[model samples]
Target chain A: MATSEDGDFLPLTPVAFDILLSLLGGEAHGYAIMRSVQERTGAEASLHAGTLYRALARLVETGWIEELERAGSDESDERRRYYRVTGVGRRVARAEALRLENQLGAARAHGLLGRA
Target chain B: MSHRRRAVTERLYRALLLTYPEQFRERHGDEMTRLFLEKGVDARRRNGRAGAFVHWLSGATDALRNGVGERWNESRQSRREAGTPTANARRTNERGGGGMDSVLKDLKYASRTLLQNRGFSVVAIVTIALGIGANTAIFSVVRAVLLQPLPYEDPQELVLLWGELRNRGITHFPTSPPDFVDFRDRADALEDLAGVSTFQASLTGDGDPVQVDVGSVTPNLFSMLGIEPVLGRNFVEEDGLPNPQGALPGQPGVLPGIVILSHALWQQRYAAAPDVIGRSIEIGGGPAEIVGVMPPGFELLMPPTAALTPNVDLWTAARLDYVNSPRNNVVLRPVGRLREGATVEQLQAQVDLIAADLMIDNPIKATAGYRLRVENFAADVTAHVRPVLLALFGAVVFVLLIACANVSNLLLVRASGRDREFAVRAALGGTRSRLIRQMLIESGLLAAVGALLGIALASGGITLLLGFQPADLPRHRNRSHRWTRPSVHGRIRYRRGCDFRNGSRDPDVQVRTRRRIEGSGRPLHEPVPKADQERGRRCGGRVVARPADRVRLDGAELRGTEQRAAWIRFRRSPYVQRRPSVRPLPAGHRSSGFQS
Candidate 1:
């Protein structure tokens, strides 16, 4: 409950935020999340396998994400572990987006951005 | 992708993942491999093989950076928690509570105690000072006389070749010119050989005429010794050859009159003139041109006889008429440098064979008891002084041991008085080893201070010794008087004392002390004391007299007849009685005997 008001996670790493944004839709395995991040960032902020997993492990530790258990015996790829954003993770992502929007509005007031 | 290519790509990624830490690899190996394989297929589908390669490169770099970073953070965290271990556990694990910190504390405590007991401190310090001072002085003398190598190239290969008359019990008689030439030419083991003869020359030109020691050496002497003159050229073959036209206007059929000045004489007579070379000076009443100036500290080859001056002031060519000289004239000392890989025994064997051949060639010329003797040049120079030096060294070492025992006894008495202090310290949690260490540190501090004082005293002692050293003692200007500093042996003795004090009843300490005692046996093992005894027996009950008694004054006022009577009367006096044991035969008489 205090996560959204204090803005404790207002400054998320580009890769971590991107991973969170990619998992916003639904549960996805690690490889799918990496592809989604590359696609969403237009390949400007690509997350490699090692960087993705390291950030994923940290996010899970901070309670911003959780590993989802397999429900059925689909067993197509047993090696892949799925991950999803927790309720706190969704709030932190919304707070970070608001913080960025406020910075952009200030930049516009000072005419630091081109008219668009 | 083909199955084989996919398998190869998976294998490479797995190998790269192994670089991570064991805990990391175990938890994440399967997941990492699956992600990498899925990305590889997607990358190949999008951009082909090059895309897969790029993905692999980025992933590998990221893996390396994070893997190392994680392990570094872990170690830092562990180190931060290291101090939380229990005190007893830490004590057993660590060698000491605080290595350098404890030593500093001990040193502080030691100084305080020593200052508190000023009277005991003075006695212990003075005793150690005397012991260390005497040891240092004697060791310096021994080092100078025997241990230091001669100032020459390959000094060990240099030897003195003396002709011996075994039946007459004279083992070091000088070699005759013919015998030297024979050995030089025939002995394959000798690299080079030269002869030297000492002479008295009166220097007359620059100032008042003064008698100075001169060495008449063969032309090749400097070359054989591997020494070069500091100024001008060494003697050449032409200098030694007899000139049909004499060097001066009146003298006829004389050798080329060339002389090389020693550095001391050069400074004294010439006032170190730059143009001293090529200048004519009077030597033995004859005009001789100065060819060169030898460096300082150059000593001439001469027996350790007190009659001769300590050092040669000048050098000249022997210029012997080798072909016409009598074979029985044995006045020149032969010195030879051994060839590479040649042993003294081999050279001696060769010289003996040559002597036998010479004896057979001329029966009357070669004496019946003639033989060859080879001796190390350095050993021969210090032969007479080694015994007296070793004896002094032994005496000083014994005195030092007695001093050590006295100081140890004093320390024991003092320590007994401090029994209560130690008990109190133990009650305050001082371990047994810690208490022992504190005691050792106190003794070590005392020894260090004593050693510093001892060095100061030893330097003064050395200066005093050198002042009284005999002029004929072989010495060099480059030799440092402070060659033996009292550090190593003093520290060893201090260590032994500390061990003894710490555990008097410990069997290990007893064994260590015994071992140290056995290891520190006499350093000089030669029969030097026996040689001293032999010399005592040889010179016993003889009136020893100085050779200065033979100095005679010649002047215009004293006519020839009166002067001769005065000289004869002076010689016959009881004070100048002929003592064969002390006084060597006069120079002229000895040379005459050699010629006979």
Candidate 2:
């Protein structure tokens, strides 16, 4: 984890932050991103199948992730679609991570982290 | 392939097939199945359990995608076709490529609106349903009764002949036997002349003696009406000749026992006996041989539903003899078929001249004078009930109209209430026509619900009408004759044909009774029968007063027509012709004589 100095930053929802962080390490499919997020958090987060697909579809529609063709497979296998984060997705994710770091840094400076 | 493994694969295929649209199943289901199986085998090889599940999901998604893609292509094609100015193309066609999307959006909106105001929607639907149901039920009755044509071949040419007894102001009198003979023999314009009369007789054989209506007709009746028996033969021409029980070549009036049964009678009583021919049945204390069965629903024509009804279960042939002199007996309804090209006007003219000549020959009988007219037989039968049905139809239509108006008013109010939502949508770029269409869709949904409810109500009403039928109704006679309660059976058993079903009855001959003076048997010019005098005494009684010895008075009229003619000689008459008597009445019990 990295920390920032400035306290002034934007607010982000936990799920959105987690999803963005999961895509940080590498490009991934929807299920792979979900699996990555679950491993790092060490916590179970339940998501309905429709909800998961809807979120991925929205993300793609909003230009955050782009669809990429599979390298080599049976022509009929559409479920093995690959996705990669866009420039806009990377910027949003970076900005969210920096804002969380800044809040953590302020808490440490105020001696509220370990002292509490 | 093992049976278990094949079954598993088949189950997965069925699950995946659901993701495809219905149209795909109809068009290319087999081809798509082959493609799915080919891919499934490869997927199973590469993947374990989890991988197999993923492959299944992929297959399902492919099917869905194909459905969506096909829809998109069809819409595009439709848009291209619409661009061409086809004859049936909508003017100002707002439904371009995105018509499906817009209609779907409207449906969604309408559903949502209905859900929000569930109470209003229910009330509107119920109201409209009741209104529509009543209209449908009554209209069906009207169609069956009034609108349907007479079930005869070339019924348009058939006509009814009425005899006018001019002296008694009796029009539409049943033709006397002598008059009928004259008409049948003298008339050249008509192809055939026939007569019919109604009588009651007890049906004795094969069951307990039960009363049944009997329609006696001249032997040539069926030939004149242009109808033939469905199972056997009709009356032959020689049967009506002057000889009694005369046997013509290929004809049997030998035993004087030839009659046909109606379809309903045959089905119920005879159990559809195929060998009913030459069977003996007792009617009116006489045995008649059953020759044939009339077609089902043939009762739609004569008396008792076209004489095909079991109202009169048996018909006997009327034999005409020239020596029988019965004038003005007025018992038989005469009908005839005109010659190929003769019109009613021409026939009526000839009939009028004949009638005038007959009147000139007999001065006393024709003194009062009457007029002659020709009417269609079908019209005469249905005239009684036609007006009532037409009135009911008019009333039902009013109810439907009121329902429509009420629904429109409710919609108008709902639209005004949702004005704010509409304005927001308009600001967001929805057109006025789109808003109107959405509102119409909501109304249509309400209408559909109402229609279903109305159907239920109508079915119930029909049951009620059928349950409470009257006895004299042409349809509910000996055939299928089951009795419940008298009230339930009082609805005038409707003929299966629409006319009697709608509560219409045809007027038969009118009976007029008068008394004749003694010594000469000649009718006298006298005042109408007094109600008080006729009520106490039997009809045809004379009131005589004895003052010095005996004063005789004549009672020349009877009140009740069906009552047998009788003579009553009163010992003393109450009223004096010219008398001056002085009697003073008390104040409270005063007599007012000639107040004017």
Candidate 3:
């Protein structure tokens, strides 16, 4: 039951938004989320492993993310902690996407960019 | 990556992970290390060793920034939620509730109350500022001129020896070269003695022919003072002997033409050349070799008064022909450093014995009333200004006392008004000492603020006083730094007694003022009559009247009747008058009795 007040958190820090976007597909361990961020950004926004965990700790404190119970499997690394974005995190990510779209519209109006 | 490198990388990442806050590390330390090793391995596989190094570098920096930032934000949030107490309150509670805690609480309460009533704080602070500022300024001057040790080794043993005529009431007369030589050789109590004289010399061949004041000192002057020249050598014993025949083109019968340039003169004329030591320069139309450059601010032997220049620009060796110089030609001023364990009285007794011997040997030259007077060099230099400085010191101290009394009275009134509050606290089991402590804390706060402002005022006040100070005032630029220590100690003592039982009736203040007033009056009453008699003797004595306008040294006009009077006084001595055929040569050409 994410409230509309979650929309007020539209301006996510770039790294935090990228982390949330990486977790959007599914629950992922810290390494998978870091690798996903690098792949999606063409390795331009590679989050260091320590930096990724610090952001995750802040995101958990803000209630925008949660650590999930790791499934016990023979190949799974016992040290890896898996995280998933909450419903509020997803809603705030959507609000941020909308805000970016409006900013793109304003830039297009001023002839600073073209529609892709 | 190789297994060895990978193992090292993993260990390094684990150490870096410890930089995070303890709680965060506990939750994610192992996970963070696993991810780092995975990234390092991936980077090494993709790019190579440089890629892994870059990854660690960027990762360490990022972790440091974000980890510290997160902890700071967390603590700030908790503080906001808990409504954190002020620093004073935290200090009190952290001390575990005792006398210190109560004092801290009282200080906090007093500061807040004073802030609410700003007018009283400002007035009291301003009053104390003026008082403390004036006192500090005068104290610095007095300390520098009177109390501070002279810039010499074992300064307490240093003294000025003057030939005094007790019957004529004439004290502090100059010494003759022969007498000085005799005393230096005969005196057992003195470690060493040196004579210094000041005169004008012309510096030519460089810039405009500028007349510079030169000091002619004995070879032992620098060694006696325990100072070395910044470059080259001090005046060696050989340097003081007359130059051999045909050593220089001009100035026949002159001492070896060697000069030690003052630091200022070296910079001005030679541009502080490293080769200045061996170079030759024309002084008074004679080429003199530069033997040394004195260190900067090395002014222990400056003339007490000079008209053309404030400081001596050069030093030369005083080569005295004791055999030819008359015993009564009293021209050199002798300064001596006593040997260890030798008191002034012992030196005085030795000096008296020597004076008696000289009188018996040269009965015509040495008057019956002649005696040797030994005075501390610092006292002799500062005797002229001691009265003025003492008076100003007294006046400022009185002002500080008045200001303190007024502030104490104001605090008393405020404390009386807070009687009901104190009574209420006492009803709650607050002891009498606690109430007094609170009052004292309030006074301490006020005094602290006042002292801070006073120090600020004093810095500016000293600069202003120095700016307008008389040209002849004995100036020491580092004096104000010395004032800070004693004034701070005084301020602490002031605060200790701020709320003592007799705060309103400080007997010490009354007694200090009485002593200072008596001290100030003594200098004015006692010294004035003696100084007046001395001045009358100089003016009305049988010395020849040489007009100041007629006296010229190296084309520089000697100004004032005082200079002329001094010159006449030196020349009219029994020995100089006895040699009537010998004319008094200009200072630069004189064979003996060189004045610096």
Write model 1 residue lDDT over B1-596, tens digit each, in one string.
Answer: 78998798788877877766677678777788777777777777777778877877777787777766655554455445655334432452265644554577778888888887788789888888888887887677778767888777788999988777777777777877777888999999999998888878787776799998888889988877878989988998878774453255337645446899999999988888879889877788876788899988887534474133557899987777666567888778888999999999999999999988987887753655788888888888788778887898898877776666566655654653343355444444455667677788788888888878887878787877778787656753334546345766566557545533533223353443444234433222222234333433332211222223322221112334564466456445554444455433222321111100
Q: Is candidate 1 or candidate 2 better by DockQ?
A: 1
10 residues in a row with least lDDT, candidate 3 chain B: B587-596
lDDT of 3 by residue, B1-596 (tens): 77897788778777766667788888888777777777777777777878877877887787777676767665455445643334433433444433443566678887877785587678877877777777777788778877887888888888888878777776766788889988888888899999887788787766678998888788888899888999989888887774554455465665546789999989987888979888777777877788999999888643253122447899988766655677777767888999899878888889889999888888653654788888777777677777888998898876776666556444533443333344344444444445456666666777777777777788787888788876667755547745563466365436534433321123243343344344434432233334433433332322222222112211232334553464465445442222333333222211111111
**Candidates sorted by DockQ, descending order?**
3, 1, 2
Task: Please report the TM-score between candidate 3 and the true structure.
Answer: 0.67
The local distance difference test score of model 2 is 0.55
**Model 2 agreement with the true structure over A1-116: per-residue lDDT tens digits:** 22241112235456555666776676765556656765787643333222343345546766766767664255644444556777776676677777777888999889988864
Model 1 residue B229 CA deviation in Å: 1.2
In candidate 2, stretches whose alpha carbon ends up further than 4 angstroms from where it belongs are: A1-116, B1-105, B185-189, B204-210, B241-254, B300-310, B322-325, B340-342, B361-365, B368-371, B463-596
First chain TM-score for all predictions:
0.85, 0.71, 0.85
Q: What i-RMS does every model get? A: 1.8, 10.7, 1.7
Tell me the deviation in Å of residue B153 in model 2: 1.9
Q: How high a TM-score does candidate 2 get?
A: 0.52
Best by TM-score: 3
